[model samples]
Target: MSEHRPVETWLTDMDGVLVHEEQAIPGAADFVQALQASGKRFLVLTNNSIFTPRDLRARLLASGIDVPEDALWTSALATAQFLADQRGGGSAYVVGEAGLLTAMHDIGFVMTERDPDYVVLGETRTYSFESITRAIRLIEKGARFIATNPDPSGPSPFGTLPATGSVAALISTATGRQPYYVGKPNPLMMRSALNRLDAHSETTIMVGDRMDTDIISGLEAGLRTVLVLTGSTRREQVETFPYRPSRIVDSVADLIRFVDHGKPATH
Candidate 1:
């Protein structure tokens, strides 16, 4: 028997739950609209740090999902929030795209290569060897290491490509320093989202596709978790994990009724 309170807020992963390969998954648009109509505080989250919320909004709009800009959260935004709270106005040597760069800039972080307070890593389609060498040297010079997310690889039309985690590993091998990741699988990300929404964990639900990152993080943060099959994890793979989600549904479509009723689904 579950002891959770009625859900008043929602935190859902963007890629697997709402979209797959830039296309809106079945019932994703309707799910977003339902949440909006219910007047519930919700956020669509992503671990991808390559694009800002505005950019992501445009992408989702093209796919027919209507999510407001402020309702969208990214690893880059979480990373910026983490940095701002930890050390205000700190400078960093960054290796990422506009999303990450803009977040740091918004927080008044000075971008530099010399004597930086941190070496910040994020996702980018074109990772330059030149920038990587600089990052390695900066870490060796005692700059703290930070990465937006620990995802080892990202999806590309051609195939899987190395992402922030893989690069962070390389930098660690070179400098003997591991980076502090500020995205999913880290309960700090969940706590940060909760703080952003002013939502309590007991009254909030986390909807995601991956068991390792999404389910685990939500469970650790004291939020009930739902695993949807519309993204990464296959149904048969659920039991392999040491921990389990509170519910396993086919997709966001199945969650619409619960949005209004706030009742636990029959498992």
Candidate 2:
């Protein structure tokens, strides 16, 4: 593809772009393997902040995808880093899981159920009104709101699940303070990912499924955006969206080949 144009690096989403639910998408692992082999670098940049990089790595390996723990960039990690830098270590009320807690703990952020200075939210397998209500009450008082990511929901093998956005909305309603999202589509998340690459923004590409967040983030960060239909995005939806992706394709496998070897399904 034009003498393997010197792409500085690649930033990609995890769930819809690489795998769906707990299952790996067709050739998704292969695509990662190919890019690594071609001397091209890729970081699994994802909005899913429910898991720590270690947990994410283990899950991927269990599912036959071998990714190093440090290769992933998660919303949870970014949030922790952001809050820690903001002197939020005093207290944090989180409505999430091990991933979210692990990240905060690593960054020295304190987690408490009551009287926290920050209220953090993420995807929960068990979201309850009682728990949400408690968080809301605290937020109404004075807690700052932080959303790991603002995904409305995600497709899983079992079924659809409530995304962290719902919790963010709940907190917003209670405190009248909108949450600061630290995940994808946010320039902050993209900025963190770019820091790892240490590359100029002009030569980087952000690939993902969702348009509002992923593609929009690339636009906001001034990076080339590639949209893959294998995730949450469908071709028809792209036609109606006002923002445009620099390139569109069927899946990550095709995208990997096109970027590295100049080959696609040719359909």
lDDT of 1 by residue, 142-220 (tens): 9999999999998889999999999999999988999999999998899999999999999989999999999999999
Per-residue lDDT of candidate 2, residues 158-205 (tens digit): 888888987787668767889989987788888888887676677677
Q: After superposition, how far is residue 205 of candidate 2 from its true place, in Å?
A: 1.2
Q: What lDDT is reached at residue 132 by model 2?
A: 90
| Model 2 alpha-carbon miss at residue 130, Å | 3.5
**Please, what is the whole-model Cα lDDT of each candidate in the order they appear?**
0.93, 0.80
Model 2 TM-score is 0.89
TM-score of each: 0.98, 0.89
Scored against the true structure, residue 4 in model 1 reaches a CA lDDT of 64
Candidate 2, residue 157: Cα displacement in angstroms equals 4.2
> What are the per-model numbers of colliding residue pairs?
0, 0
Q: In lDDT terms, which candidate is top?
A: 1
